[model samples]
Target: MSKHPLLVRDVLKRKHFESAKLIAGQQGLNRQVLWTHILEIKDFDTLINGGELILTTGVGLQLERETQIAYLENLIRNGAAALCIEIGDYFNYVPAELVAMANAHDFPIIIFEEVVRFIDITQDLHTYIINQHQQALTQLDTISRTFMELSLMPNGILKILQVLHQDTDALFLFVSEDTKSFYYPIEAKKYLHLMEDHCQQLELHEPIQLMSIDKDHFVIIPVNGLGQVWGYLCMRSALPKPSDYTLLNLERATMSIAQILMRNRMLQERQQSREDEFILALIQGEPIDLQYYQSYLPMESRNLFYRVVVFNMLDYANTFSEEDWQEIQLQNVMFVRSIIKKLGFFPTVSVRQHEIIILAFYIAADDMEENRDSFNQAIQQIVARKTPQLFEQITLTFGISNVYQSINSVQQGYKEAKTTIQMQHNELASSIYYKDLGVYRLLLHQDHVALLQYVKDYLQEILLIDQKNGNDLYQTLCVYLACNGAKNDTAEQLFIVRQTLYKRIERLENILGADFLQAPHRLNIEIAVKAYELLKKTAPDILRF
Candidate 1:
C-alpha cells in the first residue's frame, strides 16, 4: 500500500485552522500537503521540499511589491503546497500583487486574521497527516485484495472498469492500440473521445505518467504483454490528483488487465487452432460428419449452402518485415472477424500464410436469388467499408466461389476461389467471383499439365524476354486475346495509346514467331495464354519450369 497526504481542504476542517481565511488560490484547496513547515527566513525555498505548506508571519516577505511577487513565485516554483501568512504580526494586509500572483498560479494562500501560534498549527497538522497516511494504508490493502479477487473472476474488461468506477466514482476507458475504438462502461460511452484524447497523451508521455484534462486528473497505464503494448487503460478522477493508494490500484489493475488479455489470447489461439483444423478438413475434401464439427459451425452454416471468400493480402510480401508481417496478418485477422460480426454474419475466419479464408454460409430463403444477392452484397459491403482502414499501401484481392450444397464440395469451391484470385487483372476491382472466370475453367481439364507445358513452350521466348526487360509482353498478349485481338480495344483496355500497343504487338510477334497473330496461330496464342494463366493460378510451382 502506498502513502497519501492530506489536502488543504482537509486542513481547513481542523479545529486549529478555523480562524484561517483563504484569501487566494481558492482553486488549489485540494492540493495535498505532505507536511507543514514553519519558516520565517527569506531563503526558505532552498531549505524546504515539495508538497510542504509554508507557515510564517510574512516577516521576510514584506518588501517591494516586485520582491514580494518574486518571493511568492519562488515558493510556487519550489512546489510549496500553500502559503499561510499571519496578517496581525506582519504588514496590515497581504500585498495585492502577491494575492494576484497566488490566485493566478492557483498557489493556495491563507490569511490568519488572529495571531495563531505557528508551532501549534504545525504540530496538529503533522499528527493529522500521519493518521491519514496510516488510514490510507489500511484502505490500500483492502483495495489490493479486492482487485485480486476481481482479476481472478471470469469477468472481462467491463467488470474491471466497473470495480474501478465504484472505487473512484470516475469514468474509466480502455483504448486499444489502433485508437479507432475503445471500451467503456455503457454509462460512460458518452466520454469516448475524452478517453481517446487521454490515450494520445499517454502515448506522448512516458508510460505511467500522470496527466489531467479539464478539472480531472488521470493516470494512463499501458497494458503491456510479451514485450509489446496491447492497449492502455485510463482512470480519470476529479480528485485534483489521485491518492498514492489509488495510483497503486491503477498499477495493479494494469497488471490484471494484461493477465486477462494474455489469457484471452491463449484461449483464442487454442480455439483458432481447432477452427483451422476444421477449415483444412473442409478445404481438403475430407468427409465431414455434421455432428462432429457442429459446435464449431455457426448456425447459418448448418445444413446450408456455403461458399468461400479468399482475401489475399496483395502488399503483404513487400510492405512489412517477416516479424512485423506476421503480427500485421494476425491483427488483420482479428479485425476482419470483428467487422464480420458487426455486419451480422457469423463468419468462420481462418488465416493462411498470406490469405484469410472466410466461409460464408447461405441459408435457403423463400427466394434463392435474393439470398444469393444478400450474400454477395455482404462481401461487397465488407470490401467497401474495410478497404480504406487497412495498411495505407495495402490492397486486398477477394476471390469468391459459387455456392455448393454439400460441405464436401467446398474443396472445389476453395480451388475456384483461389483460381478467381489469380485471374485478377490490372483493373480496380477488389472482388471477383469464380463464375466470372468461366473461360479460364476450360483450360483446367485432364490435360492441364501437358496443355500448361505446351503453352509455356509456346510463349517461353516472350515470357523470358519480358522478364529480362521488366516488360509486360506476356500480359499484353493475354489482354490482346481477351480483347479478341482488336488492337484499339486492347490498347484502350491496357490504358496505353495505340502506338504503344502496336509496338508491344510487334515485339510479341518477333519473339513468338512471325505467324503469332495469324488466325490459326492466333487461336493457339489465345489458348496458350489462357492455359498459362490457369497453370499459374492452380499450380504456381509449375511456372518455375
Candidate 2:
C-alpha cells in the first residue's frame, strides 16, 4: 500500500538535508512536507502555500529581533511546514528570540551548520513530493475500486466505514438526520455529546471542521444522497489537521456512500412498490398468491404470531401539498422499516391512503397473556418512541392490533387497528392497541346511526343550548368531564377564570336538569361527548349532512 507524503523528520533523513539540525519545535517533527521552496526576501511569507518547507539564508531574518520574530510568526501563520536557516550566512547561530517563538508555537526551526545549495534541496524535495503524489493517486484508485465492491455488499456503507477507520487510524462515524443516534462504529456512543454541537452544520451539506472541548479536530463530509443530504462521514484524529491524502480518501469514501445510498433507495423503491401492492391487497381482504408475497411478508408468520399497526401522521397531512406528501410517505415507509427491523422481527411496511401500514411477526407465544409485557415494552420503546419524532413537522399516532396465529387474520387485525385509530381521534397519546381499547372496539362495530343517536340523546340539550345561546357550553362540558369535574382544573384547561367556569357549570346543571351531575348521568355524558368527537373526526362531512 502507498503511504502519505514525507514529514519534516523524513526530509531530515535525506543526504541533501544531512547538515540540517533541529534547533526548536521538536514536537512538530511530524509535520507533513508537501513541497519545498527557497526564500531570498523578507516578504516571502506571502509566497508560500500551506505545508511547504521554506529554506533561506536568514535573508528574511536580517532585521530587529522583534521584527524577525514577527516574520517567523507570519510564516507559521501562513502554514509553512517548517523553516530551515543557514546559520553561518546570518549570525553564525540561530537567534534565541526566534528559537523561543518557534518552540512556543510548535513551529519547527532547522539550522544548517554547513552551507547547502538551495537549488539542490528544492529539486530533490519537489521530485519526492511529485513521486508521493503519484503514489497517492495509485492508492486512491485501489481504494475507489475496493469501496465500489463494498458498496455492492450488504451494509456496504458500514463496511466502508470499518475499512476507513482502520486506514485513516481515526474515529469514523455516520450520523443520521436525527443526530440523536449513530449509524456506524457502534462504539461511537461515547462521543455523542461531543458530536451534537456539529449536527446543524452537518445538514448544510458543506464540508466543515469542528473542534471538541477535548481539543480533538473533526472533519465532517456530508453524504449527499438523492438530491438531499442523508447523513455525514465524520473523521476525528489526533493530528492537528488532516493531511490532503486523508481528505482525498474521505471524499472517495463519501462518493461510495452516496452510490450505495442511491442504489439502496432504488432497490427500496422497487421493493416498496411490490410490498405496497401485497399489503394493500392483504388489508383490503383481496386474494394473493402466498408464493409471490413470500419476500415481503415473513415466512416466520406461518408458524409464529403477527400483528398489524396503522400509523397516521396527524397535523402534517394538512400542511404539505399532495405531491410533497407523497414523497414524504415513501421516505417515511423506509424509515419506519428501519426502526421495526431493530425490534427483532420481520416487518412488511407500506403506505396506503396517506397512512403507514405495517405487519410485523412476533415470537410464538403460548398465550396472549404470556407475551403481552415484552411485546408492549417493544411497542413503547421501539415503535412508539422512535416513530413520532422521526420526521420534522410530523407527529405519528399508532393503532396496534393483538397478536394472532395465522397470517390470514391480518385483515381482521388491520381493520381493528384502523378502527382503533378512529377511537384515538388524534389524541396526545402515541398509540392505542385494540386490546387496550375495550368498549370502543365494540362501539366501532356497532351501527353508526345507533352510536350517533346515543350521543345525541345525552348531548342534544347541551348542543342546542350552546348553538341557540351563542355559548361554548358543549366544549366546556367536554373539558369539565376530561378534568374529572375539578372546577379549577377545568378553568385552567379552558383558559378561563374560576368564576366564569362556575357560572357555566351552573347553567349546564339547570339546562340539562338539576340531576344531570348525578350518578350514571356523568358517565353517559362522558361517553356521548367522546362519541361525538370521534364522529366529527372520522367523518366530519358526513356529520355536516
Candidate 3:
C-alpha cells in the first residue's frame, strides 16, 4: 500500500474548504496536515505542536497590528502547518504585513471568502486523517506479516531488503558485522562505498536518524538483535525528508530484518555448538570415524589437505571484563570465519575461551608448495589489513600448523599450532607458522623438564651471574653468539664499545668455559638460548633458576 500523510493541498479539496482561497504561502501547500485545531485565542504558545492545521476566525486578528503580527509569528514559530482564517466576519482581510510574513516563512494562510463553521472544517479534516491513519496501520500490519513470512526463508535478509525497496523505491543496503555489505536493486551497488563511509562516521549506538550525503538523503536504521547490533540498514531516497508513513514502514521492515538475523544466529549457534563438540573431540584425540562424520566436515573428500590455525587473544582477561571478553571472542570467531571463507578455504572453526581454533581444508593440488605460498600470503594479508581494524588495543597472535593429508592427524596439527604460538618470543611477529619456527621446531616438541634442564646446563652460570648482578652478561653472550663470534658486530648490536664487549666476553668465558663458541658447543649454546626464550614464554615457572 502507498501510505502518505494528508497534505495541505488535500485539505483544500474538502467540502468545508471548497470556497477557501490560499491567499499566501503557495510553497507551503505540500505541508503535512496531521490534525486540525480551532484556536481563537491570541496566545498559541503551547497549543501548537507542529503539523496541526489551525482553523480560526479573525477574532484574534481584530487586535492591534502588532498583536496580529505576533499571533501569526507565534503560529509559525510553534510549527503550525497552516492558518485558515474567516475573512468576512471578524476581519475584512488578512493584514498585509501578516500575509507578507506568512509568505516569507512558507506558513500557509487560507482565507474563507464566505462564513463557515470552524467545527465543520475541523470535523471533516480530522475524520479523514484519523481514517487515513487507521488504514495505514492496517496496511502496515499486512506488510509486517509479509516480512515475518520472509524471515523463514534461507535468503530472508536479502528478501526483506527487496520487499522494502519495492515498497519505497529507495536504495536499501545492509552491512553486516563481518563487513559484508548487501545491496538491493543491484543498481544500488554503486552507493555501497558512500553508505559505508557515512556508517563509519556515525556513532552506531545512537538512535536511528536521517542523514544527508552528497545531496542525497538516507535513513540509517540499526538492525539490533540478541542484545547487540547485527548490522545497519541504510535506505537512500531522493526526497528531502521521508514522510512519517515511510519512516514507519522502514521501522517495521528493520524489525523484521532483526528477526531474520536473530533467527540465522540462533540456527548458526546450534550448528556451531555441534561442530565445536566434534572439533573438540578431534583436537582432544578422541577416536572418530571420519566416514561417518563426513557430512559434518567442511569437505568430504579424503584427498583434501588439512591445517589447523589457533588465534590467541593476548592479555584479554586482564584487559576486559568477562562479559566483554566473551563478546570479543564471539566477534573474533565470526570475523576469522569470514576471512577464511574469503580466502576460498572451508574453515571449520571452534572457540574455546580465549582461543579460536580453525581447521582449514583445501583440495590437494599438484603444486603443494604454491598452495602453501598462497595460503601464507592470505594469512599475511589478514594480519596486515584486518587485524588492526578489529583489534586496536588488543593483541592477537596466530599460530599455523603444517598441512596433513589425513583428518586423523588433526590432533597433531592442533598441538603444533598451539606450540608455534607458545614458542614465539617476539611480540612483533604476531603470525607464525610451524614450518618457519626453525630450531624451535625441534625444541618445542621436547618435554618442558628436558628443555629446562638443557637451558640450565648451558647457561646456568651466566643466568645466575646476571640475576645476581643485574648485568648484561647473558644478553651480551646471546648477541655475541648471534653475531657468529664477531666481536665488532656483537658490540654494535649491544650498543657497547669493543673494550666493554671484551670485558663481558672475558666474564662469559670464565663462567661458560673458553671453548663455548667452538663447534658443537656453539650449536648447543644457540639451541639453549632458543630453548630458554621459548620456555620463558611458554613455561616461565620452569625457569626458576
Which candidate wins on TM-score? 2
Better of 2 and 3 by TM-score: 2
**Relative to the true structure, how large is the alpha-carbon lDDT of every model?**
0.73, 0.74, 0.80
Candidate 2, 488-520: lDDT as tens digits: 889999999999998998988887766766778
Model 2, residue 334: distance off in Å is 4.0
Model 2 whole-model lDDT (C-alpha atoms): 0.74
The lDDT-based order of candidates, best leading, equals 3, 2, 1
Task: Candidate 1: list runs displaced more than 4 Å.
Answer: 1-3, 10-22, 25-27, 33-81, 84-92, 96-107, 111-150, 153-241, 244-248, 261-281, 284-339, 349-357, 361-409, 417-446, 449-527, 530-545
In candidate 3, what are the lDDT values of residues 224-303, reduced to their tens digit? 65334567898889877888778788778878887776556545754677678778999999987776666667646656
Number of colliding residue pairs in each model: 0, 0, 0
Choose 1 or 3, whichever is better by TM-score.
3
TM-score of 3: 0.55
Report the lDDT tens digits of candidate 1 across residue range 61-162: 777777777778888999999998888657578877888888999989988888888888888988877787788778767776776677778765667788
What TM-score, over all chains together, does every model reach? 0.51, 0.60, 0.55
Q: lDDT at 191 for candidate 1? A: 66
